[model samples]
Target: MMPLDNRRLLRSIVKLTEKPDVRAFELALLATLTEIVSAKTIRLCKIHESAKPPSQKVVVDVRVSDEEPLGDDASLPTLLIDDAAFLECLAKEEKVVASIGLGPGVRIVHPVKAESKMVGFLVIECEADIPRDQELVSIMLGFYKNYVSLLTHTQRDKLTGLLNGTTFDDKLLKIITAQRVGKMRASDGKGLYYLAMLDIDHFKAVNDKFGHLYGDEVLLLFGRVMVDTFRDSDLLFRVGGEEFVVVLRDVDLAQAVAILDRFRLAIERYPFPQIGKLTTSIGATIISGEDLPASIIDRADKALYYGKNNGRNQLWIYENLIAEGKLKVAKDDSSVELF
Candidate 1:
């Protein structure tokens, strides 16, 4: 590999911090890493945890070569983190270099830590070790850690730690774009995205009866339940007071409905200290290929209204309601200005 210019590398590092969002920052980091190390393949794998019945273990979320084009034929490499070498690297929480296959190459795994917590690992494949590669990688990882901290603070809600409302537009738009371009797909080969609106039932009564402080506690506890109930890959946002949104990637109507119902049941059964038990209402819709963010959200919001109006503590699917003539189809108007 040709030597990387120090001046050029510094410029790339500066650009990393200037990225508009986390996704952009991640892509920039991968591009810079490829240029710096002349790597064949690089992957960032994050640990996603689910704490529901059947007690699942750490599920790996992998992002590979984001710079590559996404077409009908484009497919990201499937990641298998169950391998012995990968498990050992994760256990040690340190750099691990190993030869995995018959090919004349080596794989390097470096633990990625943020805010004193081990969040994920970076894996790179290269033909041979470059001089001072570990040092360079460490410095790059440090920049990532700092940038991620800042991004997290800005994008997440202070009370709930879920994504703030301001970040929802960008994330939903990006997800829609990825789906349109065939960059993301479910295991079933159907590239589907489901948007759902969730709101705590009779939340105003809770606030009135127990006071604002107790209401806040309910919100906090509910957020924790969401984290445990939803998959790590699903995008979750606290968009408004006692209201949340989740975008289910790669899941059809049945799967999405099942997941939302599970969350509702969990909330109903949960004991909230003095509050005893509480319930939630949900409205969901499958995102169509040409649907705009606002339109998709409007549909879900309508469905949520249907659930709340008919009865509290229920889940309603917009298409299902439409099929039954209970709800009319929402007009698709992307030209309207959204503020």
Candidate 2:
């Protein structure tokens, strides 16, 4: 049978990590290599420099059935090489590194590097009897280097280069779940969290008058604003269309309002190309423990509607409805307009 081709596989690896999920990208890389070399097992590891014992090494083990040829069971070399020796060789500042036949199988190691520094490593291996193909190794190593380069491009926003909308949502949900379960480190203080929804005032009008291209420019500008206004710890998602949501963990009603107010005024004061008198409306609410993600969003949307109605370019805290005597608990969806 013809052996795997390195040049073509390197190109494929370049395309793979361009995907949103890096883990998925790595898995695909191993799977492709497995086909070429007829190997058995692939284990990718991210060894952190500062981690303690078990916590330091984050390992992703991908196993293909032995019935399958060239799965994770191939005879690849393992890196029983000392940590210091491995780190020292990697200090040569190479992106792709490999070792063969130390453990039960032959193995390949690729460093995940961003901005010229090694962040982690990817390792793939196979059982003892499997012959390690030199051509395949060359191909896999080069492919891995290209994959790391693609990861840098794929994980960021096309414009602002913050995490893209979909990525942000995935990361946000993970953070929320982690914090809720105490898997994450707690912040200095605590209370009901808050979600603020912000919409650019007269956004459609700008698009209509200035053209869709400029409207995109406006959205990108607004994203920059959000990045500047919120803390690094805060989570923001461009939910859809012209709407963005900010989740502030451990924030109470009053703090939520103040933060939203600043965002509102920032939009109002900022100037843009071809668009004058820019402004935004904000709706915010303290998220309760009983609330689901949708419920929290709905409450914020209701408050946003109130802001738009009262006058655009303002902030409204949902909890203020009861205090102002303008709202009552409703049996149906009467309290807030969904759209």
Candidate 3:
């Protein structure tokens, strides 16, 4: 293959940096690199979280033509992660890190660092050894790192590194809205939906017991558990301290109850450290056409209050209260529960 024309490559790199997204930048760079150097595949791995002492590992994004599947290791070859020798060479060699004749093909691993930090890695695979002189590769990678950082911020919770509360809220709304719109024609039911609010049984206990640092850990861990337990379509939100909300779209009372039961059981089974065995009180409501988000939330809150007053670690549906006359027919100060 003809050597990559350095001047033209620089111009192309400038154009590629104009892409607005990390994936787009990766694809463009991979394509450009393939055209210039005749490489088989290009992968960009970006690592977001690392273990203590900083692993400096990155997870790659792969883009390839119809050659091979880019394979499993394309994104991030862990040989790059735990391998101190390979990394040291890349940092000091000022030359391409290559593996020739020993593997399926030549593996050229290049580190993409920004602001003196190893932000990600770019791996180029080809049939032969690749030379260094990576000015275009460096330029393209700089843009990619910035773009990935932005994408990470947009997708992650600023406090907990989970999906942001707003992002979850949006997703919940979408799923609920779709279910409501689609269920209009279902045979078993129409216009039935569910939503629930969850509040830590006594999150204040954590703050008092272990201080706010541990309290923060509890909240973060709580968010992680919620995300893990719920369906990807189910919306989970940390709307406030010790409070979360989930929308159960296209669900009847039984289904909604079952879903909440599962989450409640999961929480009850999982013992939280420092906080000990923790439980949550959940209030859920089925939505009607007359219901707005605020009203739906109010119903859930009422159910939550019922659970807290009667007992914690249980799912309380609004209909049960209405049937038992525990809740007022209309808003009035005089009808409030004495308990």
TM agreement with the true structure for every prediction = 0.84, 0.54, 0.53
lDDT of 3 by residue, 46-111 (tens): 444334233454343444211111244434235344655346545663335566555677666667
Off by over 4 Å in 3: 1-155, 172-187, 190-193, 288-290, 331-339
Query: Candidate 1 lDDT (Cα, whole model)?
Result: 0.76
RMSD of each: 4.8, 11.1, 9.3
Order the candidates by TM-score, highest first: 1, 2, 3
* Model 1 ranges off by over 4 Å: 49-81, 128-131, 179-190, 329-339
Q: Pick the candidate with the highest lDDT.
A: 1
Query: What residue pairs clash in candidate 3, if any at all?
Result: 44-60, 44-61, 45-59, 45-60, 46-59
Which has the higher TM-score value, candidate number 1 or candidate number 2? Answer: 1
The deviation in Å at residue 109 for candidate 2 is 19
Best by TM-score: 1
Residue 78 deviation, candidate 1, in Å?
A: 8.2
| Candidate 2 residue-wise lDDT at 165 | 66
Question: Candidates' lDDT values, in order?
Answer: 0.76, 0.61, 0.65
